[model samples]
Target: MFSTYLFFFLSTVALISAVMVLLSKKPIHGVLYLTLTFFTLAGHYILLNAQFLAVVHIIVYAGAIMVLFLFTVMLLNLNIEGEFQKSTLMKFVAAIAGGMLFLVLIGTLKSFDVATVGNPELTQIGLVKNLGKTLYSEYLMPFELSSILFLSAMVGAVMLGKTTKK
Candidate 1:
């Protein structure tokens, strides 16, 4: 009973924050809403007993990624007054595309077999030890490549920040 209420509360907050992220005019407000959405998602992960994922989600997304997003927005100095208004035709096209995507998602979800419960024994798959083993074994190459990519991105950012001599 408590779990159901908690799930509903979290889901409502997540959905509301997600919508606010899209509807917010200010970039900062949007970023804040996105962070709220991330927090609610992490709560959902915790409720599902995926504590490792919840921690990672809070750290990587709510902590690091949101900071990056806010920094980028500030660096760009975006303002509502400076932005151009979207054309009516562009808005119509976007609405139609969004509706189509929503329909497709609903169809995909409906096709899933809801009667089957996942194996209870497999719940430990989300534990840190299991995750570390999988990451170091099956996904080692991809992980290393991602680290290298991040390193290159940092180097590029540093190079871009350097002043050019006349």
Candidate 2:
């Protein structure tokens, strides 16, 4: 009962914040809404009994990614007034496309037979260790490569901001 109530509350907050993220004119406000969305999603992960995933979700999305977005917004000093789009046609088209997407997703899910859930055998090991083993063994190379890519992007952003005129 408590979990159900918490899930409903968190989900509503997450959805509202996500919508606000798209609607907020200030880039910083949008980034903050995005961080709220991430934190709520991490709460949902905890409700699902995936504590390790909850921590990682918070660390990755809220702590790292949203902070990066906030930094970029501040670095550019993005103004709400300068970023307004005056295209009603584009807005209408986006609304239609989003509605179609939601309909298609609901239809697809209603037609599917969900897989049966089974009890997981943890083998008496901590979840963090298990997750780390899986990540490092099965997905190490791609993970490291992505980290390098992010590092390169950081360097590029810094260089572009600094190296302008001769």
Give the TM-score (vs. native) of candidate 2: 0.80
Per-residue lDDT, model 1, residue 140, is 96
Worst 10 residues of 1 by lDDT: 78-87
lDDT of 1 at 10: 99
Worst 10 residues of 2 by lDDT: 118-127
lDDT of 1 by residue, 52-157 (tens): 8999999999999999899888888874542666888997899899999999999998998678678533588878898889999999999999999999999998
lDDT of each: 0.88, 0.82
Per-residue lDDT for 1-166 in model 2, tens only?
Answer: 7877998999999999999987887778888888888889988877766778888888888888888788777788775553668598998899899999999999999889888575333232326777789889999999899999999999998888796677
Return the lDDT, model 1, position 94.
Answer: 92
Structural similarity to truth (TM-score) of each candidate: 0.83, 0.80
Q: lDDT of candidate 2?
A: 0.82
Q: What is the number of backbone collisions in each predicted candidate, taken in the order shown?
A: 0, 0
Report residue 143 deviation for candidate 2 (angstroms): 4.4
Candidate 1: C-alpha lDDT: 0.88
